[model samples]
Target chain A: MNEATIQVQKLTKRFGDFTAVNNISFEVSTGEVFGFLGANGAGKTTAIRMLCGLSKPTSGWGRVAGFDITREPEMIKKNIGYMSQKFSLYDDLKVWENIRLFAGIYGVPHHTIATKTDEMLQRLGFASEKNSLVKSLPMGWKQKLAFSVAIFHKPKIVFLDEPTGGVDPLTRRQFWELIYEAATQGITVFVTTHYMDEAEYCNRVSIMVDGRIDAIGTPKQLKQQFESESIDEVFRKLARRATRKEV
Target chain B: MLVFLIEKEFKQIIRHSFIPKLLIVFPVMVMLVFPWAATMEIKNISINITDLDHSTLSKKLVQKISASNYFRLTGLSSSHADAIEEIEFGNADILLEIKSGFEKQLIREGATNVSISSNAVNGAKGGLGAAYLSGILQEYTMEQLAILGIKPVPVIKTTESYLFNPMLNYKIFIIPAIITMLLTMLCGFLPALNIVGEKEAGTMEQINVTPVPKFSFILAKLIPYWIIGVIALSLCFALANLFYGLTPSGSISTIYIFAAIFLLVVSGLGLIISNYSSTLQQAMFVMFFFMMIMILISGLFTPVSSMPKWAQLITMINPLKYFIQVMRAVYLKGSGMGELTVQMVALIFFAVGANIWAVISYRKTTH
Candidate 1:
């Protein structure tokens, strides 16, 4: 079996009396598209944040790209890439400038930045938009480019937090192609999303309900096990179970 | 890695074609407007005299008051009530009362008493007016003593030699204060707003997830402001020379050395504010609140000696106070590092403390 790029065991994050993420475990091997799906308050973001070194877990052990999340966050940060739900590109900055900044931040070789940027932009059909300010680009194209910048340094794992939240369908489909391309290049992809249709595209999906992983499986396996025709129906069933448990 | 961040920040600051232009044009506008609009020089104080003495002595006293540059005899009232009314209507800043028997008492006892009423609503103006009036009256009293053949060194003489500004030029005093304020606005306000601006724009989250060291992140934000602040101060000095015919009397390197430390004091303060505030608007208001308090108490417009003891004690922590003092000392007095050791040490403490506080207060983890 491939070594796990991301591994969390009994990871719990509690804010005072409220448990934000309650004792969940998951693992993603290299080059896997893992979808993290949940309702707005279901702690998908909380879990992803713990893995990305942006938030600390309350009491658990987690490792990202073989670095301890609690003890060596700096090492984890160096080995992974992250894209936020909120667009990360600076509107005032030109496209090329933003790429250069992150490339430098990720410790990419100086001699290769220009070539890598040119090749990536050319491949994404963004060659013509390199000099334009990010604000001038459409939302879809911005998110697509943001995804490319996230992995520009070839981190072992990349975490995307709702990367296509407000994107259009066609652009989102185009963005998924980039995700697949990265996955094929042996980069582990951890993504959280609201779109159930997007979850089916993942090699494996974890549905979180009220800070606990209600189910984790391949999309086809979960749909068939739940006797549901689609991933959306399976999500609704788990959501109903969470509310019933609350009652 | 740090250089890239600074380059990004500089790019953002000069992002639009108009921004760099505006940054360069700002000090010139301030130079033209601030000299005229905001000045500590007091002149044209309105005075009303009501003389019931009806004596040549009373008239002579009035002439003496009017001859001074600080006072203008704007009204001569027939009654004390009328003179009080002039003050109430804001037409007069001071009222002089000469008693009916003022000349008889002066001749008989060789001493006389007169009363003066000052509008104290503007405490600074009123206090200065009173002081000027006392100076003039002291001279007049000595003259009376001379006439009485009692010129036996009865008056305490003050031999005055003004330093830095030989003529006590208000511009010389105020120009450095204005430059300090402009630097605060640039280094202090802009960086405060920029940090929170990133939080609002969601770019902070991206930066947070990177391996960017906190110190490097802070220094990167600070570098552009530091560079711009130095340029602005030098340009303001040049403008001070060009427009106001003023130049630093001390070593320019001394001023820059102090300024480099002072910039950290202010910009670090701004960063500390940014770390506390979640929004750019909140950061702005917080910076405004602190800047107002700092500038008002920094002895910019008023002498620090004039404020109440409690207020004076508070000035010790106001970073602008030390900078203003150091700037004026170096610019006007040609004061070297030795004469400025106390202020320099205080500013250095502030710079170190504020930056440590800023970095320590900052959290790498997202909420």
Candidate 2:
């Protein structure tokens, strides 16, 4: 019912003879936490790369943040924030410096950078560690800081590619709390992840198998449609039909 | 935004435990040690003399050769065979044999042949040693004729004077080239490693996702190294002054102008290497491969004129060769922009060509 922040129609990407992402279509309204679920090589990353304007699609069309993916990649870049699976923060840089660097890159107003950095550090209870090098922080704190820095410029949409990967469950829950906070502030969250439980936290989830979206619905609806007791069962049932193994 | 990128680069460079120290120590060690070690000037050639004549003139020749700095008279033998044996044992580099009746023949016939043989295994040392001995012999003959009052036909005399480096100090020639080497390594390898380091760390992926312009990103990567290169050059000049009492003969500004263009060329080359390589190891090997070829063929240690025609042609494209010429000319010959226009144009061409290639090859998005 709400306005779609992302729109796709028959978006596909092919490499040589193999089609990486095949005719996948999806839409997510503003402020919704959309979970993109798939196996390792089911083309989730390839599709996300195309949507994020990082890779050109071989065919079809997609739009993000009111810009065509093919023609307006730079505009899409300006309106989006991305946190990759790998730790993105400069380890040698101080926490505040990392925040400032990203803020400056994202074209956050220069004057507000200091105030915003201080506010974010205080909110994360990282005020005392503001001057500490990012490498000195624990892994969980680094992930949280990376996520916060990703959205520091306050882009309309933030794409998290396995943002909570390799972290403990409790830290992951806290990370999600931050995601929820961003969503409440009207930022669309497009996230891909491996954990089934994490998928349940999404407002709606898409299950991709063999480069195609096999199912898409709310968690409860997917569970009922698959005749399963949990979203995990719904995922396993859809994932079983995958012809391509994890790469 | 560019400021932020450059600031991040400087912070990383300064924070690295080894890089900052290496920046200072590397130049100092290279300037302090390499000049003395890299000298091509031949000295202290060992000579065994066989005085078969045993005449005063023959004995005087042996003393003259020994007293001269170039040759050390290792021993005097009764026979030429003994002296040749010394050369075979490698104890002596050359053997001078004054034949029988050296002074009698010179006075009676006004001419006599003296034999000189040298082990030419080390061609430069051997050849130079023999030439120096002959010069001493000619001086002795001219003096003998003057003393004996035996007037011969008019003799053509030639007086040689060395320009630029009158004393022919090897350091004056090499120190400038060393400075060029320092800039090449500092500006060349660091930037080559920088972007690939980010790729290895996965930060490049994060930077790519931002709205940062590609040119801004590349400029940010290069500007810090350019500044570092200038600083390293200053340090080299300072050390050369302190240790070797050497200063550039020409205007310092001319050197800086060429150095500025040369830095862009090398850093651009580095960026091009970085753009193509996906891993740090890949980048380092590729850089090392290029650096070895460039530094060697650039005429850093040897003269480019001496190389084979094909190898000499390769130096035409070598940016280091042009910069080395500029440095040597400005530092030793007091040459200015007027004298170095060809090299200046070559450097500018490389600077533009390399940097444009670097920027074009750098892809912000994956294909």
Query: Which is the leading candidate under TM-score?
Result: 2
Computed on C-alphas against the true complex, the DockQ of each candidate is: 0.71, 0.78
Task: Give per-residue CA lDDT, model 2, range B275-337, as digits (tens).
Answer: 999998999999999999999999988999999999999999999999999899999889999
Per-residue lDDT for A120-154 in model 2, tens only?
98999889999999999999999999999988988
Listed for each candidate, the true contacts retained, as a fraction, are 0.87, 0.81
For candidate 2, the chain B TM-score comes to: 0.92
Quote the positional error of residue A239 for candidate 2 in Å: 2.5
List TM-scores for all candidates, in order.
0.90, 0.94
Worst 10 residues of 1 chain A by lDDT: A238-247
Over 4 Å off, model 2: B51-56, B74-89, B100-104, B144-154, B305-312
Give me the runs in candidate 1 sitting further than 4 Å from their true place.
A244-247, B16-22, B36-41, B53-69, B98-115, B127-159, B304-314
Q: Which pairs of residues clash in candidate 2, taking residues 3 or more apart in a chain or in different chains?
A: none
For model 2, what is the error of residue A104's alpha carbon versus the real structure, in angstroms, after optimal superposition? 0.2
